[model samples]
Target: MLRSIASTTALALILSGHALAEETTHDDHESVTLYRVFVGDHADPKITAFDLDKPDNRWTFETKGQSKLYGVGEGAAVVAVQSDGDQVNFIDSGISLQSHGDHSDIDIEEPEALGETLTGPRPFHLIDHAGKVVINFDRGGYAEIVDAHDLSEGEVETVRMPQARAHHGYVAPIGTGWVTSVASDAPVEGDKAPERVGLQPVAADGTPTGEVETCTAIHGEAFSGAYLATGCKEGILTVKAGSNGPEFAMLEYPSDLPAGETTGTLIGSKSMQVFLGNYGAKGLVVVDPVDEPHFRYVELPFRRIDFALDPANARFGYVLTEDGTLHKLDVLKTEVTDSAKVTEPYSMDGDWNDPRPRLAMAGDEIAMSDPKAGLVRRIAKETLEETGTIEVGGMPYNIAVVGGSGMVHEGEGHDHSGHDHSAHAHSHGDPQIYKGYFEDSQIKDRPLADYAGDWQSVYPYLQDGTLDPVWEHKAEAGEMTAEEYKDYYTTGYRTDVERITIEGDTVTFYRDGKPLTAQYSYDGYEILTYEKGNRGVRFIFEKGEGDAEAPQFLQFADHGIFPAKASHYHLYWGDDRAKLLEELTNWPTYYPSSLKPDEIVSEMLAH
Candidate 1:
């Protein structure tokens, strides 16, 4: 059922540069933030990439068969597992973020397929952890461990496990070796493979190193912080990195709870040290391996359609039920904090492969694919409001998101050793605030004069015909069609504000020609670095005297790191400054009020 690839052929193909891309660099101190959504079609042998920052930009790659996509190498690349075709293909997501002690540098290129194609029989489960990808080939009765970094560079070198009896099992990397499933020596029956009995830790050379831990009917697996967990009918089997080797334990399901309940599929939190698993058809359980009363069960109203955990916001998990409701689960609180109707009713009574909605977290938003509707809806995580939608042709099924904020420093041959240490400091405890060291001399405290002027919103110009030329110019440059560009900007520039006027410490917001003024005082600033190697500085101001309805806090972002006159700017206001910073969508932008529509179009085209 599986076939091995020739390493020499793969190396030759990659060296020919047939599927490699050139890296992209940025000027010094320039920040770059990009997130890409990879969508696999329900039935087609294709995958589409949607760049979240550039709405009009799209890329589709042909595959041997339909695949289930997974982002690996910390968002640097993606692997497409084609079980039916017995193939595994690698994709350079064209986005790489390298971390320094204080900040990270990002390099972006065009997405391309790697020359290597890992062919194996009935490739099933995949686990990406500790800089490696472990792919389970069920029919082949083996697993291949590939270094993620090498795969991203178009190199193919896999450490294959010694072949055993063919069975539906899994293997995961742990403590320099691996923890693999163990099959019983029971007599075979019919055409079905032998069932897995337990798990045993093996040396890096595929030699067994420890006794098998009893875990019957083992199915799903996940990694939470330092521990790797797998589902078992008897209990939750856990493995941790030990000084000698991998240490294993079993946390049994509490007897006081339901009797016949067990978890199958598991999801782990990246920010918090916890795991969320599906307990039966209409229930979820939060498992804490190291704590007492390990399992906390949450009963759902209906059978689950799909569930995903927010990697950035570790405290939250999302579940979409067959009733068309998406419930937001607070993992720390072990309860559903909020619920919203996001899609049409997707009944559980259907084929397991039926087209349904899948959830993926993109930056601060949650992307849910509505396959029947041929759309991917973007929902704001905090408000759970539908912010926008992407019309992905055909049924968008399995989805994976990659990319984050990174810095693009200027000039060639710049030494990364020399980091800017001025205008920044380290802080912790507040999860809302940006953690880690920030080395930017340009980011500092400034007065309100940096934005003291009467400004107009660009949303109106985009609405009228004044901005059509800008779209046409973009279309001419082979981005998107003029109409498509217009549609894209319609979502980007959407705002209710018509104008904004600032004088001294007073800020006035005009909506429908009515002015609401408020007074504010300086409340310091925070520099936020994104996963894509880009960073932003938010000048915070707290309301001192203002109208009853005015927001309590205001943050100004005009692409200016320090004190300077702003040509145009985006403003965020709310009662919570930390919560306001999480608002990536619906930023009401402002330009000089004196500029005419023609002038505005010219300004836009120049950028």
Candidate 2:
């Protein structure tokens, strides 16, 4: 199978100090990828940052009030907006990745608070664009613009709105000035803010530059490609850079849609030029600004709890419904591709601020905060399967992810030629083959020694009723019936190849007794942790001079990651390495060619 590679996330562009050093080429370099999750508590005035690479390594910072976290400055820092406390705090994520033409450099450090806080009257909506951060003070009737680069360097400089009246509105940076929501000057009763009427482009000094564009009851906003879209009661308001300043346009809702439906929350795709917005309660609208009939709606079975777009895989979006099922939406196809039950039912009848689940993407995994359980569940973005959960003390409400992949180059003057560094060894001369039960680490490029053997696919055995005993044994030990177990493995083990033989760097795939030989070179390994807290490493290899019909990439996953002969393994091959990594289903499993059907069943039951 093949999949497309999309653009990198903003985190991949934020480089650390070490990455800015003078460039030098190295003979060897190591690939490093890291992700840090920042979570805000519902009841406590604190935020926590967990290093996904090292689960035990985490840092927490106290805030002035309960906060919502946002990753800003292209992932170099996170802003904690405490609307109830009327203050905002900043934290340096300390994880940075920089792209340098051919490769990227990564730097990791302890996350810490920036010791800078912005205080105002009811700071509500925040926007990050073009290296600038804008915080709108709904009650203050003004907005403050801060340079993200300056914020990262311990400098706090703000450009404030001039003579602006109070309103529960928003402001975003565009061109050399800003596009802000315009509130009606009519007097209001009680402590309520002014009524939002339209939007206007303002100069850098907060002076209006253009006439107001009527966008009634303006609410949510997001940027995708060259367009910035905002939700409006009438329809959607879009903004783009213009020669004069900023150009604004209104895209009214199609007549065929429901009469009162509108989107209040919006998310944009990083890899594609599109936007996904929550339409009413049980529907989502996918918008393409450049195309006619810009909106397409997807109805959910239940009210949506929260939804997120996959930045890495751009075409996929995830929605969590009140029924506790996570549906994977193929944005390109405008349909649900897969669904899985991930959490207990979270009713939508309580207060809007009641603890509920929120979604954030951590690399290839989706981090969802289960407030009632006080845990953050990590689910695979591709399979929608629960991989692991991190326990947080109080209810974790809001979360933001920061980090990317890069290269760690060796210092000059060092030569490790002809040395085998693929595997690590202990001081007692034993190879550190088994990582800790809960520990996961990046594995280096390994040689073919780990898989140099003859293997036979188990799919044939399962189809021939040879694995019936194994399924019955599992049913006796588990909750499922024997027939149910058989159906599950039948779906999992469906493959064509019946055998494989590996010698040196060459591999032979036997299909229908016809063999196709190929040569491969070591690439890298990716470690995936399962729901049971155990991890498996997929040793990847790239095809070299080999059969013309052979796949470009091959991944072998066994229980071992170090340099040791494998007894059995699962094989995956595809043209796209990134896409191949996301394949959780249809893994063709194999056993030692010397093992008999009875012996294989015995080994399976033993596990």
Candidate 3:
């Protein structure tokens, strides 16, 4: 699931109105509002999907499991734990979400239960790794694999983690290999060696590769960026798909920190490789584990009740306390920037099951589910104040914001042929392009168009890789042989140069992104040389076809494979630099202090 973050905030809507989307005579447009919030009522045994903006519109579906064990994918699909039996309930989380170019919608539908998956005993952890479901059982110490689309069928394959405990561990499927935190092959207790666990690799066929990357006292696990990290007493282990296979690198803590620090709890960011975690009862740590000068911490006012990273607002982390105040954390600055009292002081002194305040997001609003009050608190993300509340009968446990505003075509046409319509005039009774706001309405600190740093765009598209759409799917369905499918459409791969930011001597390659410390010097014109310990590559920023002098392409003369029989390979601004891209792509037409769409368009027209 692509981390689809909330883009359009409430402030922008109130200030600009629908003028942000200019009605154009382009094509068919649909008017839709899709912010749907799902709350799992533990006492009631139901999952409810309701409009975050308007709570009156909602749908609740009965659930089978009560432990609140669940997972929510980016596609707005929900899988709840069915602890009573060897099955996990699959619910069609009625959020019809769609994102294209720079626009997204939060469309909602009546939530329905699709089916259930045959899982193992005590399904503890759930993770949707590239559409496949991984369910971990606590007492059985086995990880079950089931088809995410059709949970009713499939012989549930399970692999056991032979740790000397009742399975308080975690598992993640990175590509075809499953990564799990297991006890270090010895008779070790789960709570003792907080870092004395090995991140063992389980192959796609449920066979352990026997490669155990060691991490002492590994407790909690999470996915931030492309790496699946396992928290330890000493530091954190960043596990990512490497050139060979899943690579594990240890990011150790500074020597000067407290003697008994352990990473027991962690919440990672989807936009970047960062984590916000509990250092102790009254302390929190912000870690960019692999980057230089990697660690930072902030002292909390009270013990953390719960914390979640605001991926939509990438710079901040949301933390709730027993004191009933929600604190906003700044990742880059490593400080608590904003605070708002969500509920009356609900101390974390009682039993863990005692009704406590929960923190979540309803689009751009911060939602705190107060089970004790039997109300879901909504706080304005812009003003950080309590906006309103929605009353529910039971204690809301599992919560997620999914679906988005998208187009639902009203008019109908039966023609279904996939043909080139470029020759025909699209102006005759063309579907009116409804005015809509861009999905980037939430990013306010920086201009949408104004991005600084050494950016790398690659060309010829990556030619070596996995995941083919047509032929592979046929092979998977047993409709064609594997050899036959490979002969038709060969597997394609993309290089590490998807997107990058280089400033000074440091560069973070954001695709198969890796941080590199290099020395860059100008060779000639826009041509430059990047040398990292003797290995060097030539980089040139050639002018794009637009306006002749406009820089829109980046090319690497060395270190990249060139297309066969091609003259040169260049990374154009987008997929292609052809005139067609200019028409299909809705780019930033103007850059100004105020991000009003109408004003920006007017300025561009005037120019």
Q: Model 2 over residues 5-117: C-alpha lDDT tens digits?
A: 12222222111101111112233556666788899999989998887756677788999898988988658789999999999998878765443323444556677798768
Scored by lDDT, model 3 comes in at: 0.51
TM-score of 1: 0.64
Q: What C-alpha lDDT does candidate 2 achieve relative to the native structure?
A: 0.74
Of the two candidates 2 and 3, the one with more favorable lDDT, higher being better, is 2
Candidate 2 positional error at 438, Å: 46
What ranking emerges by lDDT with the best candidate at the front? 2, 1, 3
Candidate structures ordered by TM-score, highest first: 2, 1, 3
Off by over 4 Å in 3: 1-26, 65-71, 82-87, 105-107, 147-166, 184-196, 410-607
**Compared with the true structure, what per-residue lDDT tens digits does model 3 show for residues 454-565?**
3323111112222233334445544457555444222111233444443222222333543322222222212112121111122333231222222233323211221111
